[model samples]
Target: MRTKGMQRSIEDFSRALEQGYAAVYRRNFVSVTYEYMGGYIEEITGYAPEELTPEMWDSLVLHVEQKGELSGLSKEECFRMNRSGQVDRWQADMQIRTRSGQTRWVSDMSTVLRDESGDCFGTLGVLQDITERKDAEKKMADLAETLCLRNREIEADLALAREVQHALVSGQLKQFPLDVMNEKVRANFSHRYIPASTLAGDFFEILPLSEHEVGIFFCDVIGHGVRAALLTTFLRGLIEELVPQGDDPGALLGKINRSLKEVFGQSDSLLFATACYLVLDVSTGMIQFSNAGHPAPLCLQPANQVVAKLESPDQTPEPALGIVEGYAYTTQKYCLTAGEALLLYTDGVFEAYDANNEIYGEERLMAFIKQHLDLASELLMDELLHDVRCFSTSEDFEDDVCLLAVVPTAVA
Candidate 1:
C-alpha cells in the first residue's frame, strides 16, 4: 500500500500522460540501459515498460531526414556526443512506430545525468507526442508554397497586361506629323505616363480624326490597380466604337457617360471616371473641348508670357462619367497661336502631398508652367513630373499620372 503523498505523486505523474512519458536510464561508457520508465509509456507505445529494452528503444528510433540543427544526425551520434561531453543535452523531433503499427512524431529531450563526482552516469528524458503539431506545421508549409506559386502567376499576368496597354497607347500616338489647315500647320505631341503600381487607371489616346483635325482623349478611373486597369481597357474599346462621335467632344463624352451608366447599373458598388476630350484643328489652332468633371487643362502662351486654365465659357463643370445618365456635355472652344502649348493631365499631378501634408495644388502647377514656359513640350513634361515627385513626402506619387502636351506651329 502506498502512502497518501506517494499516491498523490503517482496521480500527478499519471495526469502528465496526456501528452508524454518520462524515463531514467543507466549508462556504462557509450552504452545505455533503462533504469525506470513511468507515465503512459505503455499507453503511447502499446508496449509494457518492462518490454521496452534498450535495444528495442534503439530499434524504434527510426532514421529520418531532418532539417536545421538535427540534419544528418541520429540517436547513435547523440549518444557519442553525450559521452564525449560535447553537449550537455540533446533534443530532436523523432518518428517512431508503435506496437499497433501507427507512425507518430515525438519531441525527445534528454539531459546527461551526473553523480556527486560529476562523472557521467546516464540520462533523464521525456518523449512528448507531437504528431498533431507536426501535421499542422506541414499543412501550413504547403499552403504557403501554394500561395507563393499563385502570386508568381498573377505577377506574370499583370506584366502582360501592362505591355498590352503600353502598345495600345503607342499605336494611337503613332498618327503623327499631322498636317492641317491645308498643310500649312503642323501639330506635335509629347506625353508621360506613370503608374503607382503594376497597373494604372490613367489612360490617354491621340486620334487622327482627319488630315486637318486631331483628337486627344484623357481619362482617370476612380482608383488604381487591377479593377481600374480593367475599366481603362473597357473605356478604350468604347472610345473605338464612339470614333464617329469623336468629331464633337461633347457628344462623344455624352455617349461614353451613357455607356458607363448602363454597365455600372448592374453592380452595387459605385464606379465613375473623370475625362476630357479635345479636337484640335491644326490649320486654325482652334480647340473644341469638353470635360466630364476632370481637372481643367492648362494653356501656356509663350508670346504673351501667360499661363491659365481652360475653363468652360459658363464656368460650370459637368458631372463625371457613370453619373447622371442622358446628361448633355457642352463643347467649349479655345484658340491656340504659334508658340503656345496645351497641357492636359490627370489630377495625380497636383494632388501630391508634401512633407508638411500640404498639396502641390493647381496654383503651384500653374506657377510651375508659367516659370518653365520656354522649355520644349518633352522637357516640360519630364520637369513637371520631377517637380511633383520632389514635393511629395515619399518622393513618389500615390496615384497614377498621365500628361499630354499638344503644341501646334505654322509650317514655314
Candidate 2:
C-alpha cells in the first residue's frame, strides 16, 4: 500500500512530465540503469530517446577530443558525487560533442529520488542548451583582449613621438627651463610650449643668420597631433636650411609656402601652416619681422611704463603660409630702443576659454603683460602661461600653446 506522501510525489512528477520545460532523463544508481528519456533528448545528444543509457554516459568519458578545450567538469568527480551519501542534487554546466559532429553547451540540473530508508536509488534531470550564451562570452573576452593590446601599442608610439619632438626642436634657444642669451645681440629669450595632446604641431627656432644677426621663428601647423607634428619636422629642417641663407623674412616665408604646397598638392587633404618670423640685428637694434596670418606680437616698453602692440599693416593680415602660392608676403621693420621687449605667441594664448566661455583675448593679454612688467623675461613667460591655465575651466588644454619672448638686455 502506498502512503499519501508517495501519491503526492508521483502526482508532482506527472505534472512535470506534462510541462516538459527541458529535455529530461532518469537513472537508477544500484542497477546502473538509465531509462524514461524524454522526447526532447534528441535535440541535445543527436540520438533518439531509447538509444541513451548508462553505457552511453560511460563511453563519453573515454572520448579523446576534450584535451585543451575550455570545457568544465570532471567525469570522475561527477561519478563519485552520485555515489556519495550526502549529495541530493546536481547542477553543472557541461560541453559535449553531438553524434552528428557538432559541439554544444548545456546546463544540467537533477534531483535524487531515494528509497524509504534514504538509500541511493536514481536521479531525474533536465538539461537546457546554453551554447549561444557561452559563445557570446568567449567572443567578448577576445575583443577585450584585442582592445587592450591596441591601447598599449598606441601609448608606446606616442612616447616615442614625444621624445623625437623634443629632440627636434630643443636645439633652439626658446624651449622652457633654460635661459638663452646673446651678448652680441644684447637680448634674452625664454618660452613656453604646451601640447593639447601627447603630440603637438607648434615649433620654433632661434638660428644665427650671421655674426651680428639672429632669426627667431615660430610656426603652427593647421591641426594638432601626429600629422601636424610631422609637418613641423619638415618645416623645422626647411626653415633651418632657408632662414640662415636668406636675410628677407617675407621671401623666406614665400619659399616655405611653395615647398609645402608642392608636397601636399597630390593629396586630397589640405595642409598648411602659419608662422611669425623675426630677424633681429642686435648691433643695429633693427628688427625685421613677417606675420603669416598670425597674431601680431606685443611690445613691452618699460621706459614709458606703457604696453604697445605690433600692429599688422593696413592691408588684410597675410594669409597663413602654404595656402596661397603666389601670395606676396611683406616684411615689417621696427627699431627696438633700450628697455623694450617683444612678445610672440600662437593664437591659443588669446583663444583660451574660461568657465564662462569668455576668451582671454588680446585686451586681457596686454593687460597681463602691463601688470607684470617688472618680471624678468622668463618669469614673465611663466606668469602668462599660469594665467591661461588657471583661467580655463578644464584641466587639459584644447589646443597647442606656444609663447616666445625676445627682449633687449639693456632695456631701460
- In angstroms, give how far residue 111 of model 2 lies from its true place: 7.7
Instruction: Evaluate model 1: give its lDDT.
Output: 0.79
Clashes of each: 0, 2
Candidate 2 lowest-lDDT run of ten: 62-71
How does each model score on TM-score?
0.88, 0.76
Q: Candidate 2, after superposition: displacement of residue 373 in Å?
A: 1.0
User: For residues 260-350, what per-residue lDDT tens digits would candidate 2 score against the true structure?
Assistant: 8888866677888889888887666788988888888788887687887665567468899888877778888888888888888887777
> Runs in model 1 with CA error above 4 Å?
1-31, 63-76, 174-185
Residue-wise C-alpha lDDT for candidate 1, range 276-318, written one tens digit per residue: 9999887778989999999998889887889988878778989
Candidate 2 accuracy as lDDT: 0.75
